[model samples]
Target chain A: MSLLSVRDLTVKFSNRGQSVTALNGISFDIARGERVGVVGESGAGKSITGFAMMNLLSRPGYIDGGQVLFEGKDVLKMSAREQRSLRGNRMAMIFQDPMVTLNPVLTIGQQMVETLRAHRKLSHEEARQIATVKLKEVYIPSPEARLDQYPHELSGGMRQRIVIAMALLLDPQLIIADEPTTALDVTIQADIMELLLEMCRSNMVGLMLITHDLGVVSQVTERTLVMYAGRIIEAGKTRSIINDPQHPYTQGLINALPQQTPPGSRLKQIPGSMPSLNAMPSGCPFHPRCPLANDLCRTTMPKVVQYADVEVACHEVQRLQSDLTSEAAQ
Target chain B: MLQYTFRRTIAVLPTILCLIVICFFLMRLAPGGPFTSERPLPPAIMANVLERYGLDQPLYVQLFTYLKNIFFNFDFGPSFAQRDRDVNDIIAAGFPVTLTYGFWSAVFVLVLGIPLGVIAALRQNSFWDYVMTGFAIFSQIFPNFVLAPLMVLTFTLALGLLPGGGWNGGQWEYVVMPAVALGTSYLANVARITRSSLLEVLGSPYIRTARAKGLPERTIMIRHALKPTLLPVISYMSPVFVYMITGSVFIDVFFSTGGIGQSFIDAAYTRDYSVILGLAILYSVLTFVLNLAVDLAYAAIDPKVRSGLK
Candidate 1:
């Protein structure tokens, strides 16, 4: 059974009486110990999906309609007490921008110990022990001293590691990391990503890694869901999605990777930026940026369908799959 | 941290000295001598009084004498308007009443204001949020002077639940109305700061992390949100603390609480130099010390500030 199953998750943001859908019936699952990455541009609702799954969407954003089943329990239907117990205990989240993700006033030790104590029947000392162990797992030196320090005292990379340690403190079944390394230095990004991957693997914990970096997604996630606007456009095994992208958006994202361009040449990019959520394109959210978009694509929204080794939502899936095969032969 | 606090404290002496000199000279600069009675004293008696207090001396000499007496002798001399009373003793007598209401006012602000603010932030845009915001604005607009009278009318004349005026020597019953009157503005300021800052902090990424941890909403708020929210509110309270300790003229007159403000202002009207100078020094010193205490508190609450202090 999947550790976390999200079905038809719809999120809406209501501002001054007008409601706009941020996540339009997006759905996916994470098996026990599996790593799934949700990739998209800034406004693609990647983070919204993560927040909605935890039932933690801030106002203006809410779970308009969705079923987030965690360990066979419907998260959206759970009572506040039940939801609180499920959070931080069975499913923890590591946030982006570690610099601001830890409380400025709290010592690292206090932050870690409190989270542990919140969900368990442990004294301060015992929680501190667990926190220290988690800190050591994240390769933090002088783990005891680090706990006494504040977020500001640590470098961005170190703060991120602390945040990762806090997420792993409770030995949760799944960890939802929303762009955990996005605010980090490029050099430190790989290190943080590697640490997160190792910890999750060793703990047998499932991970939903949400990020815009396809390179990191390919390296870390076993399965990948490519999000655009508020819907998943392509999802499959990470290897197949990278080797054979079916959706035009996924192809554009992959082609736009720095490595995809020849040395010293301009990087390939999707021609248009993501449409505003308030004014999403009619047929497909990605249609404006898709080269293969046609009148049918403009008039009809493509639903996710099984196509060549991937689940894709695009009118040109068949054409793209055939083109990929011929290109491979050449 | 201790060394930083000590250094800051030592650095205040020159400023205090400068403050005292300017205030002393400024008071002298104002018209009317301490002995300026409506019906003038006989010339011999006036000369005798001026000579006795050394008011007949040069301005610079009188300034030096006043500074030396305050710093070295620890004397505020005697009140010229009330011949029998010493300025220091008179001030000491008035302090307890002011401090009592000030203490209660602080308690009121913290206990009620902070939670109102937290609720407003947690329930952003809800009915409670609107109510709190409106209440804060109302409290801010009606300064204690205005609020004090309305409170007297409500609690004393209208409802008759408590006394209309008078401290009754710091009795709890008398303390209630005054505390509310004095606290309303302060409470509003605190609530506003807490609401805005906490609202900002709630939207911060760390708060989302706290929520994601599955900690109860209450736990997240008290543990993760309150401290950062307090940083700005604490700063706002520093000067207000000095004001409360010194007392307000409106509070003093309306409540009939014989506090330092009433004494100082009365001294100003009569040109009672010793009483005026005594209260001025007390205020300046209190203001400086309270500000230092706030800085020290900043270090204790925020580790970032603690590190900076180091």
Candidate 2:
């Protein structure tokens, strides 16, 4: 069984008396030690999925319908105490913008030990000992000294490392990192990503990586889900999805990478911007920006249909798969 | 921190000296002497009074002597407005009254305002939040002049829950109305500041991270959000704090509390130079000391500002 299973999860926002779908029946799963990436543009609800999984969605954005099963128990049905126990103990989250992720007023040691003591009945001295070990595991220099220092005393990269260390402090089975390296310098991004991936692998931890950077996704994720609007447009093995994207929107995202274009030339971009959530386009949410969008695509929301290695929700991809099968038989 | 406080303290001496020179010369510049009255005094009586107080000397000589008396003899001279009473005598009697109300009002404002702010922030658009916001705005609009009397009428005459006026030698019961009246402004200010400040900090990514850490909402608020929320609130406090501690003329006069604030106002009306100058020195000194304390507080709260403070 999968370590985390999100079954037909739906999130909605009721703004000014009208309810808009933010995450529309999105379903996916992560087995133990698996690494999955969810990618999309700014308003694509990528972070919402991560937040919903933890039941930490801010007000107005709520779980309209969903079953977030953690180790076979539905997290949505758990009591507040039960959920609290599960979060940061069985599962943890690492947020973007390390510069602001840790409490400015708290010392590194205080933040770390509180998290440890939250889930387990540990002495302050015991928690401190565990925190030192986690910090050392993340390659922090002089872990003991670092504990006494405040968040502002550290650099952005070091702060991120500390955040990652905090996530791993309680030996959680799953770690959800939302654009963890996006706020760091370009030179530092690769180092942080590598450290995170290495830590996850060595700890045998399931990782849910959410970001818009396809290049980073390809490097760290084994499986990838491409989201458009609030639904998953396409999902498959990261390698196949990056090399030969099935959905029209996925193709645009993968092709739009700078490396996909020759140097010094304008990079390819999807024609229209994402539709506003309240004013979402009818049928397939990606149909407006989809190059192969048709009357069927505009009229009916595509269902997730499976191919041999991919599960995609696009009418064109569905037709193309049939045509390829027929041509192969002939 | 020690070095920063020391350097900041040294910086205040010149500022206080500058205030003294400007006030000393400006008070003399006004077309009134310490002996000025609507009904002119007999020429002989005025001359005798002027010479008695050494006001008959050259303006510069009088200023030098005033400075020398203040710095060397620690004498603030006798009050020209009040007969036979010196400036020092007034301060000695009034300062303690101000201190009593000042300490209590501060305690009242902080105790009531901070928690109210945190509750409002936590319940952003709830009914209670709206009520607090409304009350904060209402308090801000009503100055102590208006508030002090209403409180007297309601708490004294109408409800009869407490005394109307009089310090009664700094008794708690007598102090309540004045402190509450004086604190109304600060209470409102602190609530609004804390509400907005905590909301901003709550929206910050750090607070979100704390939430993500599986901390209970209470823990997240008290531990992670409180200190940063307090930073701006603390900054707003420095000047207001010194003034409150020294005294507010309204509180002193309305409550019939003998305080330096009331003395300063009376001396200004009567052109009591020694009294005015002495109070000015006290205010400037208090302002400088409180500001330095605020900087040190910033250092204690955020190590990032510690180096900048020094």
Candidate 3:
């Protein structure tokens, strides 16, 4: 069985009079030790998926239907007390905006020690020692000095490292990092991703890397799931999805990437923005922007089609050979 | 830090100078001079009295002399009409009483207000929050006069539990009813501010981060949220403290307490120019100091603020 299996997860938010669906029955699984990247445009329910899995959805937004099974135990079915017990111990998650993630008034040492003490039965000194090791593991130089400093005393990158260190101290089974390095610069981004990947590799921990940057995802994640307008448009091994994208949305996302090959060549651009969830398209959400959209594509939603190891949700992909022929002709 | 403090202190100089100039002229413009009365004194006696107080000179000269005595000699002239005690002495005698009432009442408001607010915020929409909200509104609506007498009547007249008036006995009970009467309005204001600010802080990501760390809700609240939550509260406190001082004037009359408030009321009623001007200066100085303290507090709460100060 997969280490974590998210089945038919649907999350909704009701504001004023309308119920807006943030996650529309999306399903995927991460096997033990798997580095899975969930790539999507902003507002594509990527972060909401992670939040739903952790049962951390804020009020006005809630999990309407979902089964987030971790190691064969369904997370959504668990009682609040049971969920609390599992949250910081067995499973952990990090968020974007590291500057705001760590409390300003607290010393890094106090926060980390408190974090460790909360989940485990340990003395202050014991928790401090473990937290120090965790800090060292995340490659923070002068871990001892850094611990004594408050979040405001540290730079943004340093604070992010400290936040990551706190998450790693418990040695959770699964680490869901939601745009962890988005607020960071490119250089710090690479360092943080490398540190996270290295830690996961060393400890054989399952990681769900949620981000919009496919380049970052490609560097660390082995498998990639592309979500658009609250649904998984495509899913496969990272290479297959990137190189052989069957869904038009996935294809557009890949083509949009600036290529290293043929320097000075013009870059590809996705024609339009993703649709709003409140006034979403009639059937296939991406049909409005899909280049090869037909009457049937605009009228009916496509189901996830299992082709070998990958899943593609596009009606045109049914006549695969003819589509390949047409592409070749083009 | 030194530069900021120095700048702030220098900034208040023009303000103080302007206040002095305006007040000097404004008081002179009022219907009665220091010597004015229903029965007119003989011109000779009036001139003698004016010469005695150094008011025989030109207005500007008199102002300059007054300024010199105020700034250099550190002398607050004698009461304009009372003629019994100097303005400085009255202030000296009254300030400690003001401090006693203001200090205890301030302590009461913060201690009562902040926790009540925090509880109300945490239990948001629950029974206790609702009750506290009702009490807070009631405190504001119910005048200190009504509340004071009502409290004195209920606690002292009816129950014989506490003292009804001014600090007579050196006991906590003597202070309680008066302090409560004086503090009720401020307690309400502080509680309201605390509730709103805490609500905002509770929604911030750092608090959520603490919760995600699985820290107990109480620990998350008291440790993680409370301090930053207090930043706004502390900034607000200075003005509230000033308001408490100003508000105390009314409470003093109602409760028959001999504090700075009562003296201010008396000074205002009698149009004791020197005493009024002295009180004005005292109020200005206290306000400036309180504002400076608030800025220092802001620096501590937000490191960015301190760094920006550099």
Candidate 2, A1-330: lDDT as tens digits: 999999999999998899999999999999999999999999998999999999998878889997999999999999999999888899999999988888888899999999999989999999999999999999999999999998888999999999999999999999999999899999999999999999999999999999999989999999999998889888999998988888888889878888889999999998989999889888888888877889998889988888757899989878888898999999
Candidate 1 regions exceeding 4 Å error are A319-330, B1-4, B37-43, B154-163
Candidate 1 similarity to native, TM-score: 0.92
- Among residues 3 or more apart in sequence or in different chains, the pairs in candidate 2 whose N, CA or C atoms overlap within 3 Å are none
Task: Work out candidate 3's RMSD over C-alphas.
Answer: 4.7
Give the runs in model 2 whose Cα sits over 4 Å from its true position.
Answer: A324-330, B38-44, B159-161
What is the per-residue lDDT of model 3 for residues B108-211, given as tens digits with 9 covering 90 to 100?
99999999999899888899899889998898789787798899889999999987767553257766776778888878878888999999988898987876
RMSD of each: 3.1, 1.9, 4.7
Candidate 2 docking classification:
medium
- Give TM per candidate: 0.92, 0.96, 0.84
Per-residue lDDT for A297 in model 3?
Answer: 88
Each model's C-alpha lDDT? 0.87, 0.90, 0.84
Candidate 1: pairs in clash: A88-B213, A109-A147
In model 3, which runs have C-alpha deviations exceeding 4 angstroms? A16-18, A260-267, A319-330, B1-32, B51-77, B104-108, B123-188, B246-248, B252-258, B265-271, B292-310
CAPRI verdict (incorrect, acceptable, medium, high) for model 1: medium
Per-residue lDDT over B106-190 for candidate 1, one digit per residue giving the tens place of the 0 to 100 score = 8898899888888887788899999988998898789888888888888889888999877777889999888889888888878
Candidate 3 A-chain TM-score? 0.94
- TM-score: the better of candidates 2 and 3: 2
